[model samples]
Target: MHVCLFDIDGTLLNTGGAGALAMERAVGELTDGSDRPLDIPYAGRTDRAIVADIFRHYELDFGDAALRNFLGRYVEHLDEMLGQSPGLVLPGVERLLAHLHQREDVILGLLTGNFIEGARLKLRHYHLDAYFDFALGGFGDTHADRDEVARVAFNTLKAHRHPEQIDLRRLWVIGDTPADVKCGRAIGAKVVAVATGVYSSDQLAEHAPDYLAEDFEAVDELLELWPAIG
Candidate 1:
């Protein structure tokens, strides 16, 4: 079996600045202050981690209730921001997802830094949600570290226990950041670094992913490893 774990923000689709905007609004509301300049780096990081940092930046309470409220408000505004700015899918994403969805041997799951609801909202907005197996994925709702998120995904995959041995060796982590590459290594999976996000092809090359793409345009390397099957 072939398992593909994908990152959301800059991998499958872009939400323009909707995610960041929603976060700003959430933090502002949490602190009862007007939204200030959001200067945090979010690429390749988990939502909880980012929020924890935001809480620290603003000197807000880091309690459970505060986190829940902040995230709850963030989700509400994320829905609104997405409607206002529905970012386009990156190059070749639709075609690639369609082709992969056709293969019964292929299983798709999200390994995104987005919270589960946030990931679903973005995917659904771009009509990409149908292509993923939500049950088998990991979200950033709880885990702050991306590596922890990936480890959780690895555990979920192990639960399948196919009688014929579910070849975990065939697992692939596809993303656009070095963090993605490192997390893939954390679980001993092959990495496919895409330059469709902030990282350029050369920058991603330094990480030495098993495969690299300017976008999803060159998935031939991946296809060679897991061709469509009967």
Candidate 2:
């Protein structure tokens, strides 16, 4: 089977500033109004790493309990923020997903930096969650490094499916950042980088992804990458 692992934020959908706003509030709550700043870089970073950075920045406890508390609060705030300001599924995303979903040979999954719950929130809001197989991919809570997240996804796929059913050569990691390219390369998987996120096509092209597009609006080329099933 062909495996396609996708990223959430900036890739499948743009959450407006809802994610940033939720993170700011979560950090503020965790830090007890100690002037927690939202200046930390978030793109392509795992939620665990982001929260850890917030803890270090505020000189707060980074223990398991504290981290759990922070994540719980973050999820709660994320729900509220998403409800208040729902995000948008990027152009051609639904079309691409529908096209791929119609192919029985393709297995769709997620490879994102957002916590699994947060990712679900975004997807559910856009009604895109049903398109993915969560059992086959990785989440932000699984690893702090994006490359390691790729590993986690492969491992998950292996654990759930027979070894022969999965071919690394047939794997594709699709996202909108250089980190996604790095992650795909880590597993020797093909990368399809879209410029729907903060990075432009040129910026992503510098990373040498297998394919780079301005957006998914024209996915004919991308569709051609996959072979037709008999």
The best candidate by lDDT is 2
Q: What is the TM-score of each candidate against the true structure?
A: 0.94, 0.96
Per-residue error at 125 for model 1, in Å? Answer: 0.3
What is the lDDT of every predicted structure here?
0.86, 0.87
- lDDT by residue (tens digit), candidate 1, 1-230: 78888998888888889999899888887778756566788999999999999998887778788888887999999999999985889988888888888888898888888989998899999999999878787889889999999998888777754625446577899999999999999988899899888999999999999988888866565578677655
Instruction: Let me know the TM-score candidate 2 reaches against the reference structure.
Output: 0.96
RMSD of model 1, in Å? Answer: 1.7
lDDT of 1: 0.86
Q: For residues 51-162, could you state the per-residue lDDT of candidate 2 as single tens digits?
A: 7887888888787788778779888888889878856889899999999998999989998888888888888988998898778899988578989998999888889888
Tally clashes: model 2.
0
Backbone-clash count (model 1): 0
State each candidate's clash count.
0, 0
Tell me how far the alpha carbon of residue 63 in candidate 2 is from the true structure, in angstroms, after superposition.
2.6
Q: Which stretches of candidate 1 lie over 4 Å from their true place?
A: 161-164, 219-222
> Residue 106's C-alpha lDDT in candidate 1?
90
